[model samples]
Target: MESSPLSALEQRLISHLQVLYPQTDAGELARQCLSALKLDAKTPSPQPHRNIWDQRDIMLITYGDTLRWDDHPPLETLHGFVKTRLSDAISVVHLLPFFPYSSDDGFSVMDYTTVNPSVGRWRHVSALAQDFKVMGDLVINHCSSRSRWFENYKAGVEPGASYFYEADPNADLSNVVRPRTSPLLREIQTQNGIKHVWCTFSHDQIDLNFENPAVLLEFLSIIYQYLEQGIRWFRLDAVAFLWKTPGTSCINLPNTHEIIRLLRLLIEHKAEDAVIITETNIPNRENLTYFGNANEAHLIYNFSLPPLLINTLVTGSCDHLKNWLMRMPPAQQGTTYLDFVASHDGVGLRPTEGLLTEWELDNLINTMKRFGGKVSSRTLPSGDIKPYEINISLWNALSGSVAKGPDQWQFARFMCAAGIQLALEGVPALYIHSLFGTENDHDRVEHTGQLRSINRHIWNMDDLEHALNTPTHHQKVFEAMVRLLKIRRGQPAFHPNATQYVLHMGDRLFAFWRQSLDRRQSLFAIFNISDEPQSFNLAELNLIATDEWTDLVSGQKHEDLLGKVTLMPYQFLWLANKVGKLSEPN
Candidate 1:
């Protein structure tokens, strides 16, 4: 068989997959997948490719309160804010679901072409896209049942419509599985009344019929319109469920992968600078598929990460996280992974859910219930319930309320989470809220209760500014995040293409080292995830050179050959080797 001329990342992906699934013809399958996409081959190629996204490329998540702030803040004020606070470290800003939509936090698209009036007009969005590196949501997996596309399709509006997926009139929903575990689904009646529309999420969000060539073309046109308007990044939402067939869960389907590859080719041809990011919130194993051949999605969300962060904290161990990283398939050198601790949505329990044994899960559930009817754990168990329960009991005894008090400890915990993520080999995306230590928005519970509750709250600039300027505990956490961002941006070892190796540090701490292929520069990161201090011997690593290295955060330099290094509770260190002469300080 002739070898394929795939990109570096694609080759790495294929090699990793071959090891996992030995019998499958990974390369041939990838080629076939690329060939089946709906893209035009004539599109131009992107230029000025970037290896990693910077801390200045912070993705500020905006919704109700944030949008309101944007409306009130003078353009110059917003611009100045970005320039001063984030310009050097941030490169991109992602606005969440600004399109016209009906439900599920604006996932239901009433119109792909227009922005929701509640946030701003399409022109305002276009202006922002022109002024800044912006990315918008492309919810092609489904549409608002109220949208003209769905309405026209339901009314049988010939070629002008027919853009939705229509099931057999009498198809059963009894066995249909929803994203959530619930069995109740909202069904829409077509004009014939005999045929009903299947909504995977809610009645308002009707699944789009990607099987139709016309539908694909329509969406392609929609994408071009945005590209022309200066939207460089298209976050493909819920792509996993785009294609459905009987006997399958309709996720990560072969056709869906093909569609993504085709779209990548088209984007490359049309808007060369534009990129597609898939919002596949699956396990690490399945998430790699979205980055097909390194040519499909330019970026994939580290969906399993947030839970891993939480698990590491509660377990006081990095075993699960290390295992997950070891299992991650390598991608193209230039390609970047989007790592984050949280986002506009709630924390997902799915990724780490299966990692826990049934007994462990039940114990966690019971602990949450007993503590305050909510899941809460500071670290994972070393042996079993006795040690785990003792840790939680100690936490409860020392801390008055998990929700409040001991703010520094909470901030440290959050920092520990951020440290591991920023050190990982990927483009770290810090959710604006998380940076400022915004906890669960319990007040928005009612809004999230509604079909599209996630989009209900407005952005409060005053509140955000206040939090940023104040001396609150959350503010401290934000400062720590900023420090790490600044450090990561200054170090080349943190680049996306740098080689990564996970170190086994006795479970309590997760340590990793990133070095240039030529060994010109190197960075070693150690994170103490547990509440107690932990020490590890550096001699075991046998790093090429351990001479005098500077602690990026503390400005302290060590030149000792000591075999031991101790990390304080929830502390982290970013040590870079200082060779020859240190250039004039920035």
Candidate 2:
């Protein structure tokens, strides 16, 4: 009998494997990968090039246990909240690592196949998927030191005997780039002898050796299990550090990109609409490489946005923000950006490597420190410490400005940030704490002894519901965000891939124009970044003389293109030519 011809999926798998493991048998590895999928060879593969997202696709980033009730699991409570309060504003729920973990709040995953019982079971995740799109973390870079794989490695077992990246303790690993100050290698006693294994984030998190094909096959199985559990969006956490080399920086390596490509290929083949998002928190230019000609990551975190936007709001100037935005290239056809001002973690400074000056950075850092922010530092090759991220709640971080000190414009400043993010050329994600206008949890930070815990405040369901029902800053911020998000959902010009051009509205005013894909809707989003009121003539927008425009936020008509427009301290306006399809919230 003659051998069968290879399918398109198999051919793509072989190509990726050949690049990832040139010395190994690419064909056999491809067969094992296909076997991990447990799919029949005759199954017809769907074309995966279809657009999987659009303008109304807003995402909520939260821990599964962020909201809790007395007798119910946290995931069920989260599902209830999303169904009742957030169903109209957001379309996706990004559960930040519901898996059991040893440390780092779920990034150090102990088990890849099951949900943590403390949060909820797989049924709750599936339940969330029934009503809204769900996103899950892949945690691809490393595993918990307490994980089964690591234990097996210690016992010299079959699958994990050589599963970890081992390095000589005395080797010149000073060149390795990492985001943590922890020692790069940990001394562990294995079955054979004493070995020094890589530990990228912390000693509790052991880095995996992807050079072993078995390791790759194991994660493939995990991906298949996640897809079965209704997770269509995969966030590859710390993916840039997946591959390591002896003499290099050991980040953003070619083999790492190839592994991502392989994962992308396998995922697309299994589920056509599935998405892959890479969490590469590097400098602006280096972060862009994860796109890999639109074949690697379907979405990349707009890492530079958080630091740059915060600095703009605090320093009362948009020059740096505007310059950075102008330099940013629009994402390709099959890819887009994931934009957010705040998340479960802190506002990273590493992403602002070339965008901000030394003086500006020092000023911003000092301002944040004055506003109850804690600075987290990373180790350098030269044995110096540098600020890596600013750990604080978004609401608190905007409590004051660098020039004016503490002010009463905290609410308005945050709204300005949200409005600008909504109009940017990407899908906007709101952290659960950000939506609630949470302040820094100094108590939690004291309890957990983790800087990130400052922003990861947990809320009791009843107290949270009471707070929203009452008159408070949290209620005010939540209501304003909901109104803005509802309005954003209605606009076609706010599409993730819509045309965006930075407007030169002076340093005090930050402005941008977004046009719908069909060119029917044009929106001019402008914000006053300073604490003082700012005014600009509508003519600066160059509005079409024939088209009537209205301020989507204030509902003000603008027939005269030359009419002047004014924004209050830290206020924002969404002036649009046409209202989109979705109705405004009551």
Best by lDDT: 2
Please give the lDDT score at residue 493 for candidate 2: 94
The C-alpha TM-scores of every prediction are: 0.81, 0.98
Tens-digit per-residue lDDT, 342-406, candidate 2: 99999999999988988889999999999999999999877789999999999999998997788
Pick out the ten consecutive residues of candidate 1 with the lowest summed lDDT.
383-392
lDDT of 2 at 506: 92
Q: Which regions in candidate 2 have their CA more than 4 angstroms from the true location? A: 40-49, 583-586
lDDT of each: 0.62, 0.90
Which candidate tops TM-score?
2
* Cα misplacement distance, residue 483 of candidate 1 (Å): 2.3
Error of 2 at 71 (Å): 1.6
Off by over 4 Å in 1: 1-58, 64-67, 70-80, 158-161, 169-177, 181-186, 362-408, 447-459, 543-547, 579-586
Residue 573 accuracy (lDDT) in model 1: 81
lDDT of 1 by residue, 520-574 (tens): 7787888887777888776766655536687776777766645577888888888
